[model samples]
Target: SLPAAAIHRGAPGPSVPESPGAAAAAGSLFRPLSAEDGEQRPAEIESLCMNCFRNGVTRLLLTRIPFFKEIIVSSFACDSCSWSNTEIQSAGRIQEQGVRYTLAITSRQDMNREVVKTDCATARIPELDFEIPAFTQKGVLTTIEGIIDRAVAGLEQDQPIRRVTDEEVASKIDEFIGKLKQLKEVHSPFTFIIDDPSGNSFVENPHAPQKDDALVVTHYRRTPQQAAMLGLEVMGSCCSVVSPLHVLQFNTNCPECNAPANTNMKLVQIPHFKEVIIMATNCDSCGHRTNEVKSGGAIEPQGTRITLQITDPSDMTRDILKSETCSVEIPELEFELGMGALGGKFTTLEGLLKDIRDLVERNPFTLGDSSTPGKTEKLQEFIGKLNEIIEGKTKAHFIMDDPAGNSYLQNVYAPEEDPELKVERYERTFEQNEDLGLNDMKTEGYESEGASGR
Candidate 1:
C-alpha cells in the first residue's frame, strides 16, 4: 500500500519526484498521463465531474505552480465523484477579508477533506480550476517539497495525544483543518493523511479496564532523520528494563557482588536502576547463581543524604532541659477485637479514661457508725448555736409607743428634772384604779398646758 490515501476518496496526498533520490517515487501517482496522448476521461463520472482534459484532452490537471512534491490518487469511488465534458474556467487567486488564496476547481478534494466544486456559485468560498497538461510535467516530488516548505514556514507547533473519546479525536482533526484553512492564501496544494487505519489504530492489554487500556500515541512518516531517533527497549522474560540517561550521584562499593552482606559495602546510583542489578552480580560463581535483585528504591547520596549523622551522645546541661508543666500521660492499649452484634467491635476508650480520672480526684469523705448516715448529730448542734446568735442581734433596735395617755400628757407640763416624780405619781394613780385599768387613769386639766407647749 502506497498509503491509505490510495484507498480513501478525497484524502489529501503530496508527491515529490524532483528532489535527489526521489525520482523512484514518481510512479506512485494515481494514473500517469502525458500531453501527447489522446484526450481521454474516466468512463464513470459521477455528479460533480468535470473534464480532466481540455485542449488536446490528456491527463487530469490537479495543481499548478508546482508546490505539491508528491501526488497519489485514491482508487476508492463514491457517488460524489464526477466529470464534465465541457472545459472548466481557468483557476485563479481569491482575496477574502484581508487574506489571499489560490483558487482551483477539480472533482478532487483538498487536504482538509473539503470537496472542490464549481457548480454551486452561491458558495461563499471560491474553487481552483485545473487542466491535465499542467499537472503531469511538473513532477510530484518538487511539488511536495514546495508545499511542505511553504506550509511549515512561520507556522506554530504543538505536541498532542489522541485518546479514545470522540471529542478528543475530533479536536485533533479540527487543528489540522485550521492549519489548512490558514494556508489557503499560499495557493499551493498540500496533502496529509487523516484517519489512517494503521496510523490511528491502538493496541493494549485486553484484560485491563477499557478506560485504563486506552493510550495516546504519536506517529510520523518514516524519514532518515526520524529513524536516528528511534528508541530501544531491553526486556527480561517478565519485565522490560530501561536505563536512565543521567545519574544524580554515585557510591563506591565492592566492584564485584555489591551486597551489604559483603565485608566491603558501598551504595551507588547508576544512570539507570537496572544497572545496579548487573553491578550486584558482577562476580558470581557459575555453579551457584545469586538471583538477588537490586532494588531501585535505594536513596541517592546528595543534599540531605550527605548531611552529618549524629552518633555520639552529647552531655546534657540543666539549661538544655525544657521548662515543663505537670500533665498526665496515658499509655496506649491494644486489645483483641471482640465479635459483637454490630458489624464491628467498638469501645469508648477515651471516655472511660476520663471517668477514671474524675473518680480518683473526687476522694469523697467516708462516714463512721457513731453518726447518723443522712443527719449527723454534731452538725445539728453547730447549726443551732449559729442560728440563736443571729436572732438576738436582729431584735435589739426596736421602739414602742406609750400605752398610758395620761403619763405622756403630764410629761409635757412637768419639768425635765421632775420626770422621775411624774412617773412615780402616774404609777400610784394607775395602782389605785386597778379595776378601771391604765386606760381610765387620764387627766383633763393638763390638755391646755400640753397644747401650749407648757
Candidate 2:
C-alpha cells in the first residue's frame, strides 16, 4: 500500500465561532426506551450469548449452593445500527449424570422474541473446531466437488477430526472477500463470520458463529480444533487486505520485533515552501538529537518550511554543521560572514549596497558587512585587544578551510592586540571527519582564493 505522503497538500478553511442565532433548537429525535415497553428493533442490533456445561461433581457443587449458577455473556453491536440484541442462556436444574439448558433471546425492540433454541438434555456439549472456504463473490459454489476440495485443503493433514491449516488459508481467502464486501456486487453487504452454537467447542476457548452470508454456508459440528482452524482461515485472509481506514491499525515489519511497525516518514511536495519537517526524532534516554534536512532547493507542500537552515559564513560553522547534521540530512544553502562572501566583502555602505544589488540579480538573498564609519576601525581594534588579553600579545592563532577545497590553514592568529585590561579566553574546537565533501569544507571556515590569495 502507498504511504500517506501527500495527505496535507491542500489549504485549510479558517476557524471562527458561529453566532448564537445559528444554533439548533434542542429536541429529542427519537422516543426513549422504557423497561416494559416493546418496539421495533433498529436495522442493526447488538447481540450477546451465554452457554454453560457441568460435570457430575460440578452438578453436585451447583445443587448445594442456591446461587452457584455459572453464566457467561459475549456481546457485539451491529455495524449498520447501534441496536443491541442479546442471547442469554442458563444451565437449568441439574440431574445426576444429566445436563439441562435454557436460552432467552431479545432485541432492542423490547420484544422478547426467542429466535432459536435447543434443549440438549441428552447431548453433552463437546469441544470442536472446524474450517470452511471463503469466496470473493457470492454464489460461486457452482460445483460441490470444488468447494469440498477447498475445504479439504483447509484441513490439517495429520489430524483429520480437527482443522488447523485450513483456518489460516481461509483467512487469506477472506482478505479478498472483504474487498468484494465493499463493492456494489451482490455480496457487498456480507461479512465473513464464525457461527458457534454450543460455545463448548474449544474447552476454555469458545468459537462464536460468524454472521457473513456471502459464501456457501456449511455447518461443521466437529471438535474445537477444527473450529479453530476455520477461524484462522478468515482471520489470516481478511487481515492481509485492508482499506484506508484499517491501514492505520496495520503495523510495518520492524526488525526489532520481527513484526510490522508504522513508520514516521511522510512526503511533503509544495513549490513555495523550501523545506518542511515531516517528523522529528529525539533520544528518550539521552539528550542528544537531530532533525531532517531538505536539499536540491525542494520546497515542502502547502508553503510549510521545515527546520532546515541555509549556512551563513559569518556564523560559527562548527556549531551550525554539528547541529544540522546530527539528525538526518544537511541543509541546501550556506552563508559566509568572513572576509569576502556575499555583499559583506566591502567595508563601505555604498560598496556593500552595490555588491548586494549584484547578488540580488543572481540570487534572492545575500549577506554583507554592517560596520559603519565610526566603528569600521574600532571593530578591528577590538579584535586585536581581545587577542592580547587572552594570549598576553596582540596576536592569536586561527584556522580556516578554503571554499574551493584547494587550501587550508591551522594555528594562525592576529599579531597585535591591546596590552591593558584582562581578557576572557575560550578555546575553539573543530569537528573531526574522515572525508569532507565540498559542502563539508564550507563549514570548515575556509575562504576562496579571490578573497585571501594576497
Candidate 3:
C-alpha cells in the first residue's frame, strides 16, 4: 500500500500527517503556516468506483500542514451509490524513534481532542482490552469520540446482512456494539493509547498552553522488524557474525569534530560471568575517549535483581558489570539510574557512584539558569548524602535490576554466599517484554516461515 496520510473529514480535520518514508525530514508541527505560503486547492479527477462500477470523482489536495510536512488528502465520492471515503498520506521520511501516546479520558470534552492515526499505528483501550490493530483501518484524522463512532457505524453496517446470513453472529456483534457504545459514556476513567512504530501518530493535548497531567508521551528505539517494515533495512542482509580475533582495531571519525579517530574492540570473559564485548573509541584531534561494554549472549530465561547492603568503604571497591539494560537504584537516598542512562559499563562500585554524581551534576535540566533555587538546594543535599554513602558514613542499599539477566557483581568470598548481598531471579512482565521488543521477535523457525511465505 502507499504511505499513509490524513483525511480531512469523517471526524475532526487533521493538522498533521506523517508516515514512514513520508514524514518531514525537518519541521515542527507547532509552526503556523503563513498566508503568503499560498496553499493549493484540491484537484478533481474522474475515477472508477469499485463498489458501483460507475464514474466517480477523487479530489486530492497536496499541501503542507503549516510549516510542518507535506501531505496528500484524498476524498472519493460516487453520486450513484452515495458512497464516499477519505484518507491522508505523507511524502516525508520516517522518524528516528517510535512514539507512543497515552491519554486518560475523564470527561466528554476530553474525547474531542484531535488525533492523527497513521495506517501503521495501533490503537487500544486498555481498560476494555479493545485494540484496533495496525493496517486494519486506513489512516484517519479524528477525535477519540469520532473513532468510536466510526467503529460503531462499521459494526452496524454489516449487521443487517449478518442477521439474514447468520443470526447467531449478528447477535454477538450487537452485544459487542453495546459495550463499545458504553466506552464513550465516560462513566469512569479509561486509558486510550496509540503506539506507532513509524513515529507518525499524534494525540492532541487538551490543555495546550499548559502541561496536561493526564497525558504522557514516550519515545523509544524501534525494533529491527519495525525498521524492516518501514523499508529502512535491506532484505537478506549480511550476517552479524564478526571475526574470531580476540581484539580488533579500526579507524573511525569523531562524533564531535568529525576528525580522524581510532576504535578498539575486545572480547573479554569475566570470572564466573558470561563473555562481553568491550569497545573503546579515541579521537586524537578532540582528545575524547569513550568505553562501552555489551553483553555477548542471548537473553536469559528470567530477569535478575541484585541487592547489596553498603556498610563498609571496601564495599565500594567491588567490581560490577552493568549492562545497558540494567537499572540501578539507591533506595535510602531515593536516587535512581534508569536503564541506558550510563550505557554499558565495567567498573567498581566507587567508579559507578562517581559517574552517577557527574551525570547528576552536569545534567542540562538541573544546571541551567531556568532551574529553581529550591531544586538546586535539594540536589546539593542529595549529593552530600551520596558522598557520605561513598565514604561508608551512610548505610544504604544498592540495587541492580536487569531484565536480560546479564549484569553481575563480584563476590569477595569465592564459593560462599556474601552476607550483604542477595540475588533474586523472576519472570519479566509483559510490558517489560514489549519494551524489549521480545514479544514480536521471531528467532526459532523464522527461516522455515519465510520459505513458506515464498
Candidate 4:
C-alpha cells in the first residue's frame, strides 16, 4: 500500500497530474525548502490506514514548523481497534552530528518552556541523580514540568517492590518525588539535560532582548558508544535490542586467580536514585566469583551520614544499601571501612559485620608467622568485637559517612523518641566535594549548615 505521503490531495475531484519536472522539484523542496516557499506550497495527503490492519484513515500534512522550516506531521486512526498514532518527521536532511540541550530550571516559568524529546534522546536531572535513557519512552512535545511528572510516575510505579524489600529506599524515593514537585513550584533549582543522538530534539528558545541565561545549547559528534547504542553506526540497520535496559555478558580473566571468567552485567534501577550496573563474574576453572555495583547516573549533591545503634538482635536484620563512596565506621572497635573495602553492597547489619570479619581473616598478617604479637592480637580483638555485635552480646555504634548521599540505612522501625538511632544529612564540605570531583556543584542558596540530627 502507498504511504499517506504518496497519496495526493487537491481540488475535490480527481487530481490532474503535474509534469515530471514539477514532481522532481517538489521532492527537492522536501529536503531544504525555505519557510516562505514551504508556506506557499502547502500539501496534504490522506489514505486508508495501514497500521491496525484496518480500512480506517491516515493523513500526511506538510507544514512549516516555527523554528524548523519544513516537517511532515503524520496521523492515523482505526475504528476497528480504536488504534491511533501520531508522529512528526523533519523534512530536512539528517545531520551528521547530535545535539544537546541544557536548561537551568530556576523559576516556575522555566518549567513551562516547550521541550521536544525524540525517542532517541536521553534525559537527565543530575542534581536528582535521575535519568531517563533513550528508548524508555516515545517521543513527546511537552513542558519541562511535564517531563518531570512523567519521571515521577515511573518511579512511583516501582514503589511497591521497593517498599517490600527496602522501606528506607522507598522513603527516599518519596523525598525525591517531593523535590521534583517543588521544582514545579519554583521552590528549588535544578538542571534539565537532554542529549539526542539523532539531532531531532529541541527546546524552545524565546528570542528575548536579554538572552535567557538559563538555557545552553550545544552540538557535538556522537561518540562510538552513543552511535552504537542509537543504532546509528549502521545506516539502515536497527538495534537488535530496542530497550535501553538489558543484560550484557562478556569474557574476562578473573582478578583473584587469573582464570578465564564470564561476567554478566545488568542494569538495575533503584527507586529515587540513579540506575546502577550490577556485574557478577564467575571463574568456572577455579570456582571463584565476584560482584560489583557501579552507578549509571549522576553524582548526588549533598552528603549523608547514617548512625545506628546496635542494641539488640533485631537490629541485625535492618537492611542497608551502601554506596561505593560511603565510609563505614565502628568507633567502638576503632575500625573503619573505606571505599572498596567491601565494594558496594546491600546487606543487613549482621551480614555487613560478617563481611568485615571475612576481610580481616584474609589479611596476610592475620595468619602469617612473621606477624607481631600486637598486630595479631588487635586483629583478633576486632574479630571478637564483630562476633559479639552479631550475637547481640554487646551494643555498638554503626556509622556510615557518604559524601554523595547515596548510601542508606533502614530506619522505618526506629523509635521516634530514641536518641540512639539517628540519621544525619549534611552539606558536603569543600574538601569533600573536591575529593569527589564535584567542584562545579552549585551550592549557592542551599543550606550550608548540617540538617538537625534526627
State the C-alpha lDDT per candidate: 0.24, 0.23, 0.74, 0.66
lDDT, residue 61, model 2: 9
Q: After superposition, how far is residue 379 of candidate 4 from its true place, in Å?
A: 2.0
lDDT of 3 by residue, 1-454 (tens): 1112323332222233355232233233222223343442345789999899999888765544521144567789888998888876754456646789889999977887777788888999988788888887887767899888877898898899999999999999999899889888888889999999887777765332124578877666877788887778744775765454757888876543345688899888888888888889888755768888888888888999999999989999999999888989887887767565577999999999998887666542343232358657777788888999999999999999999898999888767889999999999999778766788887799899999999
lDDT, candidate 4, 1-454, per-residue tens: 0122322331121111256566444442233223333234333344566655657665555543333334555556676877666665554434446777888888777886667777778999898788999888776656788788888888898899999999999999999888877778877788899998877777754321113467776555566788887656555654653224677888887644344689988877654345667788988755768777666566666788889988888889877778777888888886766543466777788888887787666433242332357757766776777899999999999999988777767764443434556777788888677556567557674554444432
- Location of the lowest summed lDDT over 10 successive residues in candidate 1: 317-326
Query: Candidate 4 — what's its lDDT?
Result: 0.66
Query: Quick one: ranking by TM-score, best first?
Result: 3, 4, 1, 2
lDDT of 1 by residue, 350-451 (tens): 222232233222211111121234433433343343233223321111111111211011122223432211221113234223312334436576888788
Checking candidate 4 for backbone clashes, the offending pairs are none
Which of the two, 2 or 3, has more lDDT?
3
Q: Of the candidates shown, which would achieve the greatest TM-score relative to the real structure? A: 3
Q: What's the CA RMSD of model 4 in angstroms? A: 26.9
Candidate 1 overall Cα lDDT vs. reference? Answer: 0.24
* Regions more than 4 Å wrong, model 1: 1-34, 39-76, 79-176, 185-454
**Which parts of model 3 have CA positions greater than 4 angstroms off?**
1-219, 223-245, 447-454
- The 10 consecutive residues of candidate 4 with the worst lDDT sum are 8-17
Tell me the lDDT of model 3 at 212: 58
